[model samples]
Target chain A: MGIQSVQIGFKHICIMTTVLIALILFLSFICLIALPSPKEIIESLKSSEMIFSLKLTLISALISTILVMIVGTPAAYALARFSFFGKRLIMTILDLPIAMPEVVLGLALLLLFGRTPLGTLLEDIGIRVVFTKIGVVIAEFFTALPYAMRMLYSTFETISTRYELVARSLGYSSFETFMKVTLPMARSGIIAALVIAFARSVGTFGTVLILAGGTYMVTETLPVTLYLNMSYGNLGMAITSGLLLLGVSFITIYMVEKFGGRKI
Target chain B: MSGFLIVKNIHVDLGEFKIEDITFIVDEKDYVCVIGPTGSGKTILVETIAGLHKPRKGVIILDGRDITSLPPEKRNIGIVYQDYALFPHMTVFDNIAFGLKKRISKKDEILREVKAIAQRLEIEHLLHRKPTTLSGGEQQRVALARALIVRPKLLLMDEPFSALDFNTRTRLRKLVREVVSEYGTTVIHVTHDFEDVWSLARKVIVMYRGRILQYDTVEEVFNRPCCELVASFVDINVMSGIVVFSNDKTIVRVGDIEIVSKDRVCEGHRVKVFIRPERILISKSKPVSKFDNVVRGFIEDLERQGNILRVQVRIGSICLKCISTPNVLGSLDLELGSSVYICFRSSDVRLLVES
Candidate 1:
């Protein structure tokens, strides 16, 4: 074949592959939609077990996101601004969870909370974290901390340190300068990070399932509910939870793009 | 009077360049210009005094107190950057009021001070507008107003006018001079423009390779540079030769040419000669005076740089560049490859110390 014919043939093959992928995705989406009408989905969503699971999922995720922000702001700021020994090693270890599979992370957390002296000490203090409501939060936190930290670190990095210096020169102390200048500058980034962390925590499956044991109504979140119902052959409840999770993710991404995609 | 602000042997090593044994003193309300080429640690030097960069060695004393270890906030020094660096999110009024709010508690007083300074800078109308919405000159005025509203003990500007157009630069220079004099703020401005020195500074410090080469009055540093390096960096011509005694005066010879200098140098001692380009006069024929230095050379090139014309004449291996007005070139009918007489007074030939 001539060069032009070969080029046209390659373009045709590329279009065909793209169309095939789109077709498969669309067919799967249609199948998911055809499985339930709005009335059936709403009925399943309003069921007592689904209601409890969804409420617990949202509350635990919100708490986890707040905890992540409160603890991650300082950690991310320190990583972004300061140079000290072992910083690179610390940064690499912090990012390790993002690279590792969530199942492995779940197994590691399980061992730490189930088999370690630290876990026993916490249990003696009446803080039971294994297979409880608190366990769901702990699992979500472990899954979401790295993403929150990365987003916040990039946010702090984008801001010039000169703003703080200028504030300091204006007769304000370091803490005051940060409160007045740097925090306001990084507001949008912090919001975006909160949304992402909350979304990640809500959808967390492997970590929550292993640590919280997918118990019904007591420690079950939406993902755990979906997993439990799928194992029990309750297809309607499982698909309803899946659709709810998808809706939450779409809203979170839309809000992030609308507000945080511009300058910090 | 002797100790307004003293920097005692400050040393900082940032890996690329370091300031070693740099020391200077600025009297209160002194206008000092630190002139140097790029990457000469000029910004580091000023920022060190502003308490932004902690010196690796030595102390910074301000107003009879040691502020070397103090944080930038406690130093009370205002710094204006070349980029203007006004907070993009804040309006001009808010930007100017930022420092004032930290000091004064009353809102009316802050408004009065901001308006007064803004009016002085002729940026009062831009008070409600964000910094990004203002023009470059307006933003610069707001930056100045913000820095000055605080009435800082020391004002440090790093090439503040380098970003503006020529007319705006000249206008801002005049405005800065007026505002600084009215405030009587001790100022240390770092710039590469010689016009900043000529128009604003009473004292000039020429820096190179992270060291102060010459620190003296503007007249002293311009007329009497210390060495060949300072001469070249300052764009002055320096020739080295022995001083020969002739007719109750001394003459310095470069190659086969002899030129009389009014400045006294010891016979048999080598001295560095300095002359500014604008001090020389070019003529088609020799002038009437035979005592001054006059040389006949062919004009190798003529270039009009801005409003001034640069005439290069070939005299042996030494090519001397003289700056003249376009009117002077027209009157002399000078062109390339034409023989011309270059005359400069004996008093204009400065004999500097040879290293």
Candidate 2:
């Protein structure tokens, strides 16, 4: 009943909660990795379908991440720096994908690129988005763009505009200042964002499933591969795909930890 | 009309701090210091002149060119902040060479210029180190070298010595004066430290509530402040009274005390009296002298501000502030509630109309 005892009790509760969750996750991962024999897992990993899925996932994720960074960095900088007429509305729309369900975002994107006039105009230009390999990249880009932009926006916000002003006063134009000062200052943040965007793009499942159709050996990524094989009752292939996705996650987290704290 | 830089009726509204109808002129190579309390829009005024913020309505003409709408890069102005604002990503050498590189593309020329400025600022050894690794004084020297390497048309410094220690500030002040004089660069320094004004400024601009209260030579602003706000800001005591005697000396009676001023005034006319605290002398005993005013009062308060002690003495209803050194306080053995005589000569008091 004493204050010290209660404080000790609260600390124990926090530590217990963290340890309990970590233990459960570790046990679940063990169960997944132990579902099949080692030889069967190796065979599943060497399968043609698994190879195609792994290659597709990496290529699509890389393309999507590059596209996201190129488009989102300026958007986030604008949101952090300038005041426009519809800034609030634009910010809300940009953040909508992060808060909304991924399947819903996929459905909205499907409608925009499939049935709308803009979709028809794109089809006239001989560009097919839905139910194709391009749909995988498009889905991943949309799924990861908001997270990358949110990260970059806070990064730009933390940097004082005074640095940019100093550069401008030192005979650099606005764009030149951005390149020389602002971007270098945000270097670590940009690296962290890139890691997160690549991770998010590789792990995107619902959007890819709904838009890219999760086609076998054609548009399937690792997550889609796991889903498809699980439906077909192939435990070895499903577990192998899960293991590969876990490895990618581990690498991305390692990349973030390695490069996130580097000083310019 | 004869000034090198003319700021005509400029208005700026940044929502938090608004500057209204500010107009001032700076002659070429004049070292002007802007002194004001926080949130007085001194920074905004300099930024507006530096082309960082466009004034809502006014004209800024520098060297006979209307540069009101030009960008900061096009204006060729250099600014140094109190925090240094040095680029953390660049080395001290690269930071000093940044502006020079923009003008001259050759790498060797840029190196020569950066080294010259670095040597002038006494920061040659710090060229290879990052700004974060250096001390505050060192970083400020680097910032000065960066700003001065370009030989800017006008240099604006926002309390550049505020973050440094007393010794470092004194050294940097000497260095800044020497370097700025050698370059003949016009400077508009904004600071809350009066030492900067006394040591560096030939002209002082006192701003209050987003408006400039007075702009004149340092002696005039400190000795003969134009208004009550300027008087208080310059640490001069302001008292209102009616001129009761207007002959050989003008005697103003406030409450029960009569103070004499050397300035001429009409009889029975209302006026305001300004007296500098350092000009008044405090004593424990009544001194017989040819002094114009000697009043008996009790010490209301005593405050030690650095080397000088500020004593507030209350005579009847009015309290006058007087400045004394710690040595004087120790010798006189003054404390709160100690009765004392305050003496000031008539010529030390400046007067103006009450309107």
Candidate 3:
């Protein structure tokens, strides 16, 4: 065969692989939605257990995303802007949650909150974390922080330091320059990071399951609800929870697609 | 001692590029242009003075105040980069008003000051547009207005006009000259373009390998460079010759050609001779003038650079570069391998140290 035909064959194979995988995923989602009658799915969604799980998931993800942004933005900026001692080590530690298995991260968190002195200090202050509702937010926060920070770091890196110099020459302090120039230029990136962080927080299952105990009707989130109903062989409730998580994933992908590119 | 700004023994180590013992002085309202090749530490010197990069060892005294350890915001120095570096998110009006807001609180006062500078820069109509929406020249004017509105003690421009077309650069040069004079602002402009030095510089600083080669008046630096490197940088011809005496006049014999000089040096002593390229006059035939040094040579190479044609003339073993206009080349009908007579006056030759 000639080179042109070989190149064309390679292109077709790659494209065919992509299409086949995408079609399989689409058909799987369709099977989940079509397995149950519409009336049964509606009833499962309106049930008290499903309602509590959905509310808890949304609230915990919201709180965790906000907390992640608050701590991650400055950390990412520091990583992107400055060169200091142990920066690589700190970055590797931050990326551990993203690279290691979610169950491993959850186990580490379990030991920290259950058997450590810091966890006991929090209990003394009446701020319970382990096996509590607050534990859900804590688990989600740790799970989502690395992705948010990675996105924000790249965003801050794409912004030239010359803009900050120009602002400084105009008599603004360092903090003032960051607020006026850096933050404004990073608007789209921050939005994309928030969407991804919220999505990651809401989809967290293993971490929340291990640390928050995944108790039914008390600390249960949407993912936890899916797991609990699967164990009880409640197919209607399990399929409904899976559908809700899929919807959140689609919205998150759309929002991120709208705001991912660098604007300034 | 009467200098307005003094940089004393500055040493900076930036790993890739460093400046050692870099020192210079600028009088008040002097437009100093720093010209050098790429990676010659031109930008680092300006950034150090702007307090963006602190020198390892140096003292920068502006207006009799030592701003060595001060932050950029506290130094009262304004800098305009080659890229303009305008806040892309802000309107042109807000950009010009940014520095003014730090000094003026009221909105009306800020508006008035911004309007005044914007009108002076002829960018008043572009006040509502973002920097990314404006043209290159328009964005540069906005940057200049933003820097000048605050009435800084000194302005540092790092090749601010290098990004524009020739016509726009010429126009902005004139605008900057007029506006800077009106504001009485001192400027340190770093550029690689010779036109910028000729048109904008009152004093020129020639840098090479992170060291100041020559810092003097523009005329002196162009006409009488101190060293061979400075001479080459300013497009001056540098040749080594031995001092010879003939008819009670000091002359230098360079490669079988004897050229007289007004400067006195001991006979039989080796010396370096310098001559400006534009000072050398080329002719199709030797003229009747006996006072000037005239020699016949063949044209070795011809290259056109903009309006000027750079002709390399071969005279024996040495090659002399001659600058002539294209019109002159056309009129003289000069071509490769064409024989020509080159003449230069004795007063133009200056003798310096050996090698």
Candidate 4:
């Protein structure tokens, strides 16, 4: 009798508790969203500075997403397919940014490009990254690269190397096989990585601030707008930027489920 | 030395499994079956021939040209995998036209060539569909069509029909025979199924633990296996029988039944008789072909070994295992507790001299 009553309690009580927790969490987001009036949000969004920050955010995220995919694809393919010395260490280091705080990554990039010989060597070549828009791009790339690599690495791991071998036997070169076979097979994964990368790059604040100084209307992105406005007690501006970020995230999630969900 | 394809001393170390010191040759238009257990390097040898894997130390010569350093694309070889890796993103027609597209620039000519082979393989109707929408047998045909459409100098297959149903596998075997004869393309196939050896192979290479145990004609390998490993692998039925001198035929008395063999045997000498299951025919009454050996036995049991249905019969103290089509068994109404006659020719019965 006791066991039967315990099973009944688990069936009802556990589900109810889970629903309650989820409901409270969702209500918290709703409360955060209601902090700003729609009219105040419209007024803040109308500001030219907010428009400039939004445009800069989209442009930098696009560039960083491209940069991440360009360098991450080959790195992910090699790590998934080949055996090399220090492979474990390399994988761990590549994944470290995703695990560590974004601030740490920003500080590390700041130091490396701050006053080091490599930084000076670049400065001699008329290229400066520190406290510049390029610094924002660099920070976003480093912050977004690990997630892109992880997505593509697992994608390559699921594909059979035999397909490449068959293409080669059928008179296609290795590079041709990669473009023709591996790329098409991994289309879903590439798209997922791109979406994740763009989202991460747009939302990157701590790293961008540390490296690019979150300069008003210059290195300021959407996340930087939110951070700077919240610090200055401009709740309307911060909440509007946060809402825009949420809309982008919602679109990305919908695109993922509609296109790439079945494949994954 | 004069063979069209020669693999001289191939050694590949893949950590978990390795094929060592492998040497073999195939004549023009020869169909060779590499038979072995799982992990015996059969697939590796076939892949090495296709130039997919480079030998650690060996020379691969094709048509008097040393192609040891040539890449797979330059070697002009084609391979079909067991899973039928048919480019899921491409239509069946595009998959078949993939290799031809590289060499033929004319769009119409490529279409004509692909259609020709597609019609031959009976997959012309499926040309517009993606591979994922096709059945296993249809997918296998598409894979075959893709490999054969390019008219490659050498074709390597790794258990190509193993993933198909029994009926489809049988039909594909006939199709393979027809295509090979029509194209006259030399082939190297890896398989664990005995039916592949019987129906498709002209020569057989038995491998064990990465080395060739024996390589010979189908007759030599089946009749006179070189070692116990090969014998057990081929599973030839051997029976202890005593030789008896008849008028002109050398008769062997196994249990209470007398069987005839064409091999020379002295009178009153003990010998071991070897025969294959498919070589023995089961009949409702005595067979009329003047077959030398005839024995009466009752059906002991029956079992299905892949597509071949094996029947065990009890004739006196000795039991014999034989295979026949299910239709034949049905037509004969043979079942357990049913009596039947088994007949075989003198040529099918080989006598190994026992001292």
Candidate 5:
């Protein structure tokens, strides 16, 4: 039904509910914009630990997004185009990290690294993951992987396999077809996926907290910094980190919606 | 062995629609249309030939090379889909050159080849436009250019014109014929439209229920469908009639109506009669030709079939469908419940078989 032609009483109720919901969101966003005084934000930014966390957060999120696209593209492609044994089981396991709580995933990773033989071998080789910067990357990677796969899978699914067949018939090998044809077609979806994965990686807290221990300055990504600062009664720093996250998420949603056609 | 493209006894099990021992051959430079009802395994058969789907049984040989086990890219066979699967992200030039680039590494050679094919297909002007911006016909032409520019050994088109407007279909049909012939490429086209068969195909293969019923020259299949299902599938009006009298002209009585046929049958024998709807004429007045078998009937129903109007006439207990141009129908003052004279030549009424 057209909104203009709705029943009067119901329309009034609906419009009131929608406007009220919008106002709630608008007021909250206004608080985010207004709460951090310019001086307070500058002070938080000037803090050496805050600067380290920002730098580390950006680096790790970039690394994770790249790793996500590299690993997730093929996995998504396989799940989308190929028929193989144990397909459904593989899909379920890949999505389980997304379905389960991030803290639980972080806890599981903590145990496997702290108690498992693979972790011991890596430790013996002078490489460590638990309670380290490397552990931060690992936790963020698993947390953001399912989101990337979901995006890339839907992206690959929208492209007609016929195009690939045509490319193949025209004499390009399968890999070439993907690069010249499938990749170009899926560019927009890739952008959307990158934005999402980066945002997820940036906001990842519980997993990073549990695995990396939310140390004072070492493993303090943005979310970890917010958690650690709030626990220390550093309201200005905590609010600053939260606002930074909110700004990144706004950009992510804006980018996706702007180029939303490619999303599945 | 009979031709450059041979699909021998191919069988593919796709769960919903199985290709059961399907086989056909296209002589060098021959344009063959594989016509079938929906779910008749036409796409599956063409895909099998294109190396998109490996057949469970049988072999596909193109230019004397066994390609059944090869992947689609290695077989060098191009396919054009009904939806014109032109890559939306690429400009028309890039799309046409996409396949060409794989074979030719030099930029100028690829440019020259793509421009040549695009010019021939009259889509050279659309090279800079993305496929999404091009019209449906333009997109299909770009698709054709992309397939043809590669100089494939075999080109498989899956209902390419099925999604285009009639004017565009007619244009693309001629364009496809001219371009493919110029390249001397063998083509296997899958379509349910008879127009594609009549306008473009040198040979026609009639399929039904995932099986090939008849494969022969287009004239032979249209005039002489090998099975009852094929006859009906091709839109022939089939009716069971009893042979009333036999002579130089045979008379058959269907229900309370009598039809004249050229095929002789023994008296009192039951037979199936086949007549194409386009072969029958609907006029308000009787034709003076002695060769015409005229019968009076009231219009039972009228359905608009694109440019033609299909008038179903109630003749005794059977409804005979007669197709007439809308112009003819408009001037004839025809309507439901209105009486009209439907006539067909004795030669058009073929006797299928005696039961």
Candidate 6:
């Protein structure tokens, strides 16, 4: 009886999915036909604000991705390979950002950078983060770190420790083995993580808005550009940025699928 | 030689498994096979010797030099794993050349060494291919070549043939023995297969529950197991009985059965006797033989394990298992409840030393 009901449920799900896909296609078609032409979209894209936001988004996303990989690789490797005091607590805290709401993370980062000793230390060092382009990268880094670390952690976890043991036995030090063997084996996963982190950083909005304040032509990433322009009743500019963000997401996912060969 | 390799009082506690008071030694070029069941800390002990694990307390001396604190890489020891841990990104040639590359600076010389070793292992044809494309036997040979090409102080194998089919395993065992002998490399092989112990091992170390139970020559460990656990692990029949007479041959009586063994034992002393299953012969009727021990019994059961057949014959209250070939079973037409004669030479029975 349960099997029969499951079979019926599967049939219903298949029908529902087909209907939902068709509805999405029809709505997309209507929107495409009703909206401005590609010429107008291109003209809007040529605007100085649009160009600046796109450039800033790419640059900051690249920086954030590099930062995330630099910090996340070692963090993930340590979590996957070692056992020390408070390891579970550290892992739990690392994973907390993944489950926490974006606004909460954004507000937490804002307070830490705006009111804490770290903020004052940075201020004394002449490194102004809050309300600056640097704040955007800092926010993007925090937002994308959890996702990048999760990918890298699982990737390192999938590789057996025996490979390192074999390398060590072959007269290579532990660090050398990791560099020559483990890192090479985990290359695809690292590439996938970079792609994902870059995409996440490019699309980040709430944290950037709270920390960088989303000022026009200064700290406006693509998501912030979309939000700021939409609030100003600039629908074409907002949708153009939206389409660019969608294209970036599409390209990143395509590259990850093409090169990674495994789901990240 | 003066104990070429010595492990003195090694102790390691790794939460799940621990080794305590482990002490053993192997002469130079001695092929020692460590046999134990799963979770017996056999792999851990070898890995510790390879410097993969730091023993909480111990000293590993190789050729009279203490390498207790040396890392595996610095120790110049090679290891071959059961999975054949070849680098997937590298060609077979590069995989074999990796360690040699680190040692030698010349590229052409590295190529020459790799080609020579590959030719020796008969993997020259597969040198350009990736490891994933090779068969289990080919991959194992490549792993062995990679380890042996380094010419390390010692070579360790962790159940290198356990993953292969029976035919592949036997073939690779012969190949491994030949290659290691050609290299004149000292080896420590860990295996659960007694065939490996019999065919390749010069020395046998039997381990149970994180401790060495017996370390001796292959013949001694197989023919004369040290304890009941080693006896069962080695699949030899162990019986505890009282010695009744001591003359040219020692006679032992178990229950109402009398068995004669050539091993020296005091008369009227209680002793445990071990007899290998393959040493016993099955005949349809009582045969004319002066070899002494012959008992008549009915076939209780038959079990086919690989090529050999295990025939269970009941002699009074004790049910003895005798190993025979399929041809013998077919020729004798031995069936259940058929009366048969179980014959074994007195010299084949061993008297275990009491602890």
How does each model score on lDDT? 0.87, 0.92, 0.92, 0.89, 0.87, 0.89
Better of 1 and 2 by lDDT: 2
Model 6 scores a TM of: 0.96
lDDT (Cα, tens digit) per residue for candidate 2, span A1-264: 699999999999999999999999999998988877999999998999999999999999999999999999999999999988999999999998999888998888889999999989988999999889999999999999999999899889988887888899988999999999999999999999999999999999999988888888888999999999999999899999999989988998898888776464
lDDT of 1 at B144: 84
Model 3, B1-355: lDDT tens per residue?
A: 5489999999999889999899899999999999988989999999999998889998999999999999999999999999999999899999999999999899998998888988999999999998999889999999999999999999999999999999999999999999999999999999999899999899999999999998999988987788878888899888889988844457899997888988788888898888788888889978888547788899999999988989889999788888999899889998999999998888887777574
Better of 4 and 6 by DockQ: 4
User: Candidate 5 has what TM-score?
Assistant: 0.90
DockQ of each: 0.63, 0.75, 0.88, 0.63, 0.65, 0.62
lDDT of 5 by residue, A124-169 (tens): 9987999999899889999999998998899999998888888888
Per candidate, the number of residue pairs that clash is 0, 0, 0, 0, 0, 1
Interface RMSD, prediction 6: 2.4
Q: Candidate 1 lDDT, tens digit per residue, A1-264?
A: 699999999999999999999999878877777777788789898899999999999999999999999999989999998888999999999999889887788888888988899889999999888888898999999899999999899998988877777778888898897778877788888888999999999999888888877788898999888889889998889889988898898899998897677473
lDDT of 4 at B37: 93
DockQ of 2: 0.75
Between prediction 3 and prediction 4, the one with superior lDDT is 3
The C-alpha stretches of model 3 lying farther than 4 A from their native spots are B245-250, B263-269, B288-291
Error of 3 at A108 (Å): 0.4
lDDT of 6 by residue, A29-109 (tens): 567445867876898799999999999999999999999999999999999999899999999998898888877888898
lDDT of 5 by residue, B1-355 (tens): 6778888888898788788977777888898999988888889888888777778899888888888899887888888999988887778898898877777799999889888888899988888998888889999998888888878888889999988888888988888888888899888899978889998898999888889999999876776577787887787788888998999989999988889999888888888888889899998998888645899999999999778888899988998978888898889877889998999999988886653
Candidate 1 C-alpha error for residue B4, in Å: 1.2
Please write out the lDDT profile of model 4 over residues A172-252, one tens digit for every residue.
998999999999999998898889899889989889999988999999999999988999999889888888898888788
Alpha-carbon error at A36 in model 6, in Å?
2.9
User: Residue A259 lDDT in model 5?
Assistant: 72
- How does candidate 2 score on lDDT? 0.92
